[model samples]
Target: MAIHPPAQEALTPPAPPAPDRLTGRARLVLLVLCAAQFMVSLDFSVLNVALPVLGDDLGLSRSGLQWAITAFALPSGGFLLLFGRIADLYGRRRMFLAGLAVFGAASLLATLAWNPAAFLTGRALQGLGAAVIVPTGMSLLTTTFPEGPLRDRALGISGTLLSLGFTVGMVAGGTLTDTLGWRSTMGLLTVAAVAVLATAPALLTESRTPDRPRLDIPGAATVTGGLLALIYALSTAAEHGFGRGDVQIALVLGVALLIAFAVVESRARTPLVSLPMLRRRTVAFGNLGGLLTFSMMTTVVFVLTLYLQEVLDLSAFGTGLVFGVQGLASVVAGVYAPKVIGRIGARRTLSFSLLGQGLFIAALLGLGADSGVWLATAAVSLASVCHLGAIIAYGLTVTSGVPNEEQGLATGLVTTTQQVGLTVGIPLLGVIATADSSLYDGVRTVVAVAAALLIVAAGVVATGLRTVSSPAGAETSPAAAKPSLAAAESSPAAAKSSPSGD
Candidate 1:
């Protein structure tokens, strides 16, 4: 027989379409992905305004029924890494769609729920879906948009959408609860999820590791369990005393389980959290600084919220308008983060952002009950700008230099710290504020403490992120870790091919 090339060897993938060629479809994909993020972010607060109604309808007390929030937060905050890694190993598109379905189904369950038990079940399921969607959506976004301006813009938009979601959720919750019913809040989510599910399969492309490794069941279990314990402890600590027995037990056990997870990750052939990845300065200290930054920013809002409503006697609408300044500032900062990063570099942006945040907090120390709203408004807006900058910069720093196969893990870590930050921030600082004789006095104390914390966080960013070397493959090129959507369309097999050409 005549010599012939193997049939399999002759097979070839279609040429990858370049990033610039698919601008229309690219924008569609970005829109769909951001919508999902908005949905996930909205779920975090949409139910807050409905809580009293829910409590009354379910015949429960404030304390007795509060688990609805906890149930959602616990899983959403906990399972981000596990789900993100799963998306990378299996398929990002698959996980994203499944999450949408789960979230929608859970919203339906809550809408029809007749009792607390049913509602709680739905909330927890929603959290699970939120956890899955966020990291996966982020991974998809980064991978879809090539590095540099394209990638930066995508992240900036994502940050903006996420901030808008939080504010919109709280506002929508009250409006819907007042006009419709508590179930209307969930009904809104169900409708949104259904819409996302219907369109995503077409707008997004599927991509996974070429040689997907076997799932790390132990790492998944330990991390998920540990995060659950930690989230619950922090959540309860916010309401109950931190010294409460359950908090102490959960804290200790959570730490132990996490330690065990670290050990497992260190030894695993294919770890869920690659040890080498964490060794990167941007990944390690960046996340730590992110944690501190998020906590301080959130705590500031929490204290000021109490001061405005309880002491200053601002109405709910007035409070909303006041917070509107912060929201607007956040939007502006997030929109500009990409350009800022382009000009100043991610490390500098992060460091300066943290430093700015500390100064803003210090300025808040000068405000008193009688201080004009403009002073409070200006301080809050400026502080919010800094907070948004850090959030975006830290995200870029961590995701830089990672590979496509690991972007899921990278984004997962970024989001996990966010959830952890939100969970711990208010409670930790609320204790200090409440300990004082008066609320505004405690507000001043909170400002001092938050300023100190932000200063420390700035140091961390300077030392851990700014000072780190640009080790080869350590976020050297965005395309390495983030493949373009066109590339994913042409060849799923090329997902892990080369870092040089995105």
Candidate 2:
């Protein structure tokens, strides 16, 4: 009161100027980006619950119906790298909007389809759109948020939303297929895609990067073909025997093409994925963990849904209600996982989560046709929580290690690995499930194999992670420390002279 400057004025330096209000426009853009991400992620699981209904309606044979799922997954997984490079060369906003358009159009086509073939065609197109959307979304987010806690929070939300989408899609698909028909499920997808498309223009801004590269046509062809061949072979081997001549040929050709693509990338002026990024232990091992986690999770969903409906004689709605418990658990785990990581460290958290997931998968073997619904629900819920924890931890580890510029590529690789794992896991594990006449016995075998795979993945991550300390414990790079302290001490003139915004 006695001529003292206001306490606020003395403590704070004129607000350091409110760093540009995260403009209303920017918020809208982030919303649209996240919406597209949700749509793509939802599509991955939406069809799982609707598969039987769709097959029956369209008179699809078992193998033929399987292709409907495969058509979407195989293309999306294989084309991720190609699309990531495309987003880098073209504009992320441009690719993202185009993807939404394609996805919406495809969903419309799917809604109108009277035959399995037509529906499969639409699914393939949707996969193409997905291949574009995921990497582009990551690229846009990387450019928008800058690195640090802000980006981590944004990505954490993104990851949580993705998990939520998976849960919602399964439940919604079952409800729609039961009440409104499978076509209505497709129609729902169309609406979501259209909404994202309509909102993109006003909300999203184009990324500013110098020197966009030419499209890598050869790389795209080789990688896409390789992935297609590999997945096709896997699917066929699941249907036929692995020793089939066609399967052998496909495996050989696919491996050779992938090798050729790698060689081409090494020589290309603008490679689809930087070879050095793969050398980083975090990126490589984190992706491996994602692959294993999603692979088993997808298979578990597939098998359990079948068990609930076919063996236990539950209605679609009842099954949804049962599965909803797992969804709730996943949401809680995903929301709280960052805090858990902060306390336990990412490496330990990831290992423990994976181990938990493995035990849950093994526990599922106890559920038989006579098992109580609550028993099944509790096991699945625990597994889902573990799944969420593993995903968030691994995601944090991978994203943190890369430079801001490479986030798109890194995210694309992680998404691709999960997609490929989903595609492969279902058919591979489904084979184990179907090999026996006794349904319960087959499910037990399937769950056992999945549990083993997760355990192996946990071991791989544990071994790989021995070199690095906790996320905050060790600076991955020496340069990371200098910038923050220097920025605090710098004059305005010196701050502006720095290459990167500290």
Candidate 3:
């Protein structure tokens, strides 16, 4: 009689909630995700002001101190593609939480570091965590918000938070370094990471998929090693002369490895990067434009920071306060940029913004060591606005052109390019700037060159813009495109997912 009852059990059906629908809980989840994004972006620039203090406390030389920054940047930039794919194959929310955990742990380790090597290791782990967080955050946001005004608003807000995070970090870093010492900066990051981790389980929802691709181990190692080598070589050249044998050797090896990576991607059944995506006009031009734009921005910041400190003789606090004007300008510009793009269209808006950025950067050349404080600040402020507008517009274009499935890969590629540009910009431009007698004179030269680069980047976008029209005669530029797509194929996810759908 009991054996008959054992055969009667029925399987329960799974939950029926629509994945595309944005529920109240979905909005809350998105907010938490965006907060995490803000925190990660903030940490990138936050450490800039605290570097000197950290160096002194840890007995790090100038070269060693620079490694502290590079450690975070190198992993984040190089491993972006690898991590973005991991999120897609695994789960965006799961990967994001894992990243936050790693980030928190690394920050804790950094806070306790008694030597340069330990601190660098911690920074590298933090970078690895960031590599997971950034693209995954965008992917989750895209999944939660369907394409339209809501998605645009969310993306715009994310953009604003990115700039705001950097501002807050710089301000907080300086204040903390001055008051509590540099170690507190890492502690602060840890606190933020913990908050993110705690909120994630409740606010974040996981996406279910029937298939998971195998890890692209070779692709991961090749890209990571290649980028690290390239950046390391460039950074070393910045410190020591470019003529050094070690720098040359690293550069050669990096180029060779990257070439091999390209070959591997073409043959692999499950390639890490989607080579075909690189052939898309939108992806190629937008990414190249982003690279140039970010490089110019990073170089400008580097030169201005030095000019303020060395030439203007401003203290760290004073520099932060002064640079706050740029941040404010960027925030304002970033907030309004979407509206502006909506009205004028992406190509025109991008052209105008890039031209403005170039003019503003070139304008900096007119300022001398004896120039008035207001004049210098005003120049930087104007450049900041232009830079902010260009970045927002460029970001929109880059994310909008690709199909939803490729958004994550696209985003990763763009982000990686931007990071590479930034990593190389300082050294490349700094060398040119310092080739002259006076530091002020060198800065002027660098600004002029950066302005030229912006102009060229603008030209690239202008050329690409003519080709991005929809069948309806309306532009499908980043601003106009709707964000509707499934979890795996969503636009936001495409921003940093694997180039291959796998």
Candidate 4:
């Protein structure tokens, strides 16, 4: 008797048909994911303007008050990679829902905290929730939408909301703190979390890699510790000069541990971040561009905030209005960013936007002690447009052409770049601003450095991404592909499987 080979269906599954346009269900899914991300970004800066009032209410000391912010930053930036991988292995939907629950509970805890310790604990827990939410939410978005216009447009909207959330938080935090109280800020996050949680379970689908890899405990420990130490060092260095012993020790420890992590990953069979993945031009240079854009733009914002408050003597509320305008500009730019990416490709768009951002930032050199606020407003508003473009394009560049199996890893790196840059940039550049004898001179010098870096990064990204192609078993140019409606016939099985089908 002769035995027949395995049937074709058993060997190879049919490719999922990509949707030409987002269906009502798909659109709802996008909304919930973006809302979750927006909440994460809002928390990053919402408390900043309220710190003074929050401290007075909780009777927190100056140094202790800083922990309200740092506590959140530490875990959110540190644990992103570990949580991202776990989500890929277990289930994105499960991790996302879990994160939302944690974030909501922490926000409520923070809202009710009457003492420094309680508030700090709540903030730290919120950070832990954020670490899980950001990466998993992002991976879900990428997997939900096929790698074409749909994903690009979704990312543009998502990126815009993330930036808007921070700006809105800044504005609203001040308004709410002055009117209602500091507790209202945290309460706001709680409400947002609840809203997203309500809709996410029904609309979103579960996704994960086909293979279940063992969790790399050693890799996770080193990376998490290294990031925590690095962020702590930077935050401390910004306050007390880097000459402090503890800061020096932390910096050294972070670098050393990160180096060790690299070595361990090289040897691990199931590495948290595979060496080949980093070798990909799109991932490497794309994240490099992301780090540069997020870091420099945030640093510029920090300098401008100082300039507005100290040099110009504007009230916190007024300063927030300035950023609110920038946020509006970001919204406009985000609306058009996907179209730009479609026409020129994500790589070219990334380069062009960076160049534009650098030029506008350079225009801020005209700012002086008695200069009108309009200059900063106009410059940042225009730069923000470019900034939003770069952000959306960078997301597309980094995640485009990546396989569904590694979407978590890809998004983890993208978010790591974003969170680390946003968290670290202010401190790294704030130190420089404070070191100068003349405040105006220091601000100018910082912008000049930031501008030069953005321009340089633009060139580097353009060069690196020139000949980019997809990884094994992905479209050759997902960012550049224009999917035809006829080819985008709906597949019910694909809709059900969602990410796995893609």
TM-score of each: 0.89, 0.85, 0.86, 0.91
Identify the leading candidate in terms of lDDT. 4
lDDT of 2 by residue, 22-59 (tens): 56665676677778888888897788778888888889
- Model 1 Cα shift for residue 412 (angstroms): 0.8
1-502 per-residue lDDT for model 4 (tens digits): 9997655345457765665588888889999999999999999888988998888889999988878888998899999989999999999999999999999999999999978989999999999999999999999999998877788889989999998998988888888888999999999999999999998999988998867989898899999999999988887777777899998999999999999999999999899988888887888888888998999999999999988988889987788789889999999988998887777778888889999999999999999778759999999999999999889888888787667778898899999999888867777787788789988788998999999999999999888886433332122343335543323443455444544455
Best by TM-score: 4
Give candidate 4's error at residue 402 in angstroms: 1.3
What is the per-residue lDDT of model 1 for residues 1-502, given as tens digits with 9 covering 90 to 100?
9986655433444454434333888889999999999998899889988999989998767775668889999999999999999999999999999999999999999999988889899999999999999999999998888656677778888888887788788788989999999999999999999999999998899987767899999999999999999999989888877889999999999999999999999999989998878887788877977898888887887888788888788888887788777888888988787788777777888888899989988988877786556677789889888888888778888887666878899999999999999889888888888778998899999899999988877876687654432322123433334555644655645554434335
TM-score of 4: 0.91
Clashing pairs in 1: 400-475, 401-474, 401-475, 404-481
- Worst lDDT run of 10 residues, candidate 1, spans 469-478
lDDT scores for all predictions?
A: 0.84, 0.76, 0.76, 0.87
The lDDT of model 3 is 0.76
Compose the digit string of candidate 3's lDDT tens values, residues 36-124: 88888887887887887788888999988778887888788778887777777778789889999999999999999989888999999
lDDT at position 350, candidate 1: 83
Cα deviation of 262 in candidate 3 (Å)? 1.8
lDDT of 3 at 73: 81
Q: Once superposed on the true structure, which residue ranges of model 1 sit more than 4 Å away at CA?
A: 1-22, 466-502
Stronger candidate by lDDT (3 vs 4): 4
